[model samples]
Target: MAQTNNATLIRREIITRLCRLFAEGRLEDIDRIALAMAPRNAQTNGSRCCIHKARAIIKYRIMALLGFNVADETDELESLYSYALRALAGTDRGEGVLTVVGEACTSCVKSNYVVSNLCRGCLASNCMVSCPKNAIVMENGQAKIDSLKCVGCGLCKEACPYHAIIYVPIPCEESCPVKAISQNSEGIEQIDYTKCIHCGRCMMACPFGAIMYKSHLISILHQMMKADKPVVAMLAPAVCGQFRASYGQLVTALGKLGFADIFEVAQGAELTARHEAEELGHVLATGQQFMATSCCPAWVELTEKHLTQLKPFVSETWTPMRYTAGLVRDKYPDAVVVFIGPCVAKQAEALKYPGVDYVMTFEELGSLMIARGIDLQVFEVEEQGAVIPERQFAASSGVLNSVAAYYSGEQIKPLVISGLHKKNMAVLRRLATGKHDWNMIEVMACEGGCLSGPGGVSSPDVARKLFNAQSGVHTEMLVQ
Candidate 1:
């Protein structure tokens, strides 16, 4: 099977290895196996100065998989093997959802402007002329930018007709929507937990695979292995097109993995739509300016943490995952409900809801399946009695469509905020200032909705194609 990207491939490889170890009951051997993962005796290291350094990086990755934060200062004296043993014993669980692998961080240059080889030493010197800071100077017929004086306005690059100036951004810093990621004194990237929304953009952005989240896989596997209580799998709508197998086949596969029941989060989305519509009607009756959807946890966190003024306008209804977990708990009171979805923000969101015992991403689910050697093709497709949700729910316009269905006769002016990036932040700020005409705003922190989530198995375009093809077959069988 073709991999999506290097980051996903590396993440999958680590998860797969950890799953294998857990399956084989080899927790005691993590130190030996993890150190031996890279070619320690090779003449040249694959990614570092020496094999030992490479092994160190692998150890940190292993620690992350075992549910330990690689950046935690308290764990500075602990060994990877010790962490593995603790995970196996089910003694210690990590404190944070995300961490930076300090050893793996490359400490990329902070300068945004660089003189590329494309510079032809043009006589006009448009770059120097356009630079407002006087940071750009002609040196030996080449444009030289003083890092100290440059303000990263990009005017010099924009003015140059040759496109000689290249902007070298710090990937993690640039990808962070809330400016939560920054370089420490030693130049290693650090995440401010208070400001972070756990979107996992930095994890995807870092080319060196420095940023990672502590996986709940081991805890989940332990729950299954114990079989003390029923374990239920709550799947997101994005799961529709994630696997090559049909929904029924995937359902059967989850049963084999020891899940007592499977619940579709989209079913909860249906409930959310009803609640939100009523809430919007109430808000409108009260003459409130506008309201934003609170289904996306990252967007909610963005409002609560950074955009305080917007908090009053956010919906009070629970997210699909939280609502679904509640339904599962009602059905099986003692069951440990595990939410399997595409968004990494769900990991942080799950913490707020006690009903949700664990949160695993689609990428993690794929790795778990691969590690367990569960072949979806061999599992015969059967009737799952699953509810097919609004197809738009998995994409950008789904929320608006669902809510609009409830208020059919009303003139509802809705705005869709696709992906919460820097530009979108400005728009949200304007909306918070009560300067917009929109009555409703549907915000998706990930572009193309949940399908393009950070933990998604396939690209949004491919996932959408697969989802549309399957929707026709499932639509007729849908309960509502």
Candidate 2:
């Protein structure tokens, strides 16, 4: 789920820089960010057409960072300081979690298979023979593709012996499982929210870093800074693998950042799994074929928007985030609950949960730590041997394992959909139509589970290694 790229780094740099200003009590200086970022006669230059264009993109990026939707901009003359004021006034949040930064969009073309210059124009003419649409033609000693007739099936690309034909893809469009994003008439990408699953795949896939989410960072920061109410942080279990910190150290870090309390969502996962197990038992007793986990908000959104028929098969149990948020509400009743976890989907999900007031990503949390100069390496807790059930919630098929513990029926037959690509989605569609032996399906939007979510900080490989080695071993005892 993680592709190491400079675009993602640039976004994080902007987040951290803005957070630094907030921490320094200099929110009025927000307008100076873009200018400072792209100064005149810089030592090195970026890949933009001009330094001014780069700064314009950064300004839009800052607007998103300030919790404003770039798409809602009616005035080209609006200043960053104005947006910052609106954010502190608590009116900057957008309609949805995501928006396209047109200034930053590269306007990628529709994916097509093109015959490159490497074509041999061989006498065999396999490309012509394999073209289902007859869209391939040899012209002037090179193979040419009829773009008008080409359906992008890539048959010619595969049939050519020399591999002269290549398929160019729009990463965001291809990454979206629901086909919710597409190019407009101007070739700028826009999202169809009616079909979007809020997976953040398009946001993560866009190479130009045009697709961005309306951040709650400023709002949450204001709440923490105000300290009017208990500002609690509900952490996901995947946090153990992020920040290079042990569980105890993360709790310490949260407190250092002015969190009034910390609550482990894993603690709530136990209740989720138990309730889901009971529901599964009831569903099976009533002769249902299968049931899917509903913890992944993106997965739930997918079924709700695209696979309406499969919605009945999804479990009705509360998500760990919801249950944990409910627990905080039960205790404080008026606390400003902020969920800190690894996925962008949670930001949208939190709006409906009532218990959660805002959401922050692991990426943003890392930036927040950097802004506050809180290093994970500094806080070390004395190790103990007590096992924690909630810690297992981070890994793949973790929910299935948890449910299997509470399930009293026959041994659970599980299907793990690690990533929601087209091929994997076809499998889910097939299951909805036909009978399947598997009883429980665990669908994680991110391939390696929550640790590799769109809001993740580390690479999937690195996260898996760290999570596997550290799970069930670290936690703040009171909170976890």
lDDT of 1 by residue, 1-480 (tens): 112876568678878877777888886676775455665567543557887777777788878877777776475657766886687687656565789999989889756889898898899999999899999888887889987788889999899999999989998999889999888878789889889988777887788889888888888998998999999999888777687767777778888877899997888888888888888988988899888898898899999899899999999988877888889988999998899988778888888767898888888888988888988899876654545555457777787778777764357788888887788878988887787688889898886778788887887777777766654322211110
Q: What Cα-based lDDT does every candidate model obtain?
A: 0.80, 0.84
Q: Candidate 2 residues 242-329, lDDT tens each?
A: 7666788888999999999999898889899999999999998899989999999999998888888999999999999998988999
What are the candidates' C-alpha RMSDs? Answer: 3.9, 3.8
Error of 1 at 296 (Å): 0.4
Off by over 4 Å in 2: 43-46, 120-150, 155-162, 385-387, 473-480
lDDT of 2 at 89: 92
Query: Where does candidate 1 stray beyond 4 Å?
Result: 1-3, 41-50, 73-77, 88-95, 117-150, 154-164, 383-386, 390-392, 471-480
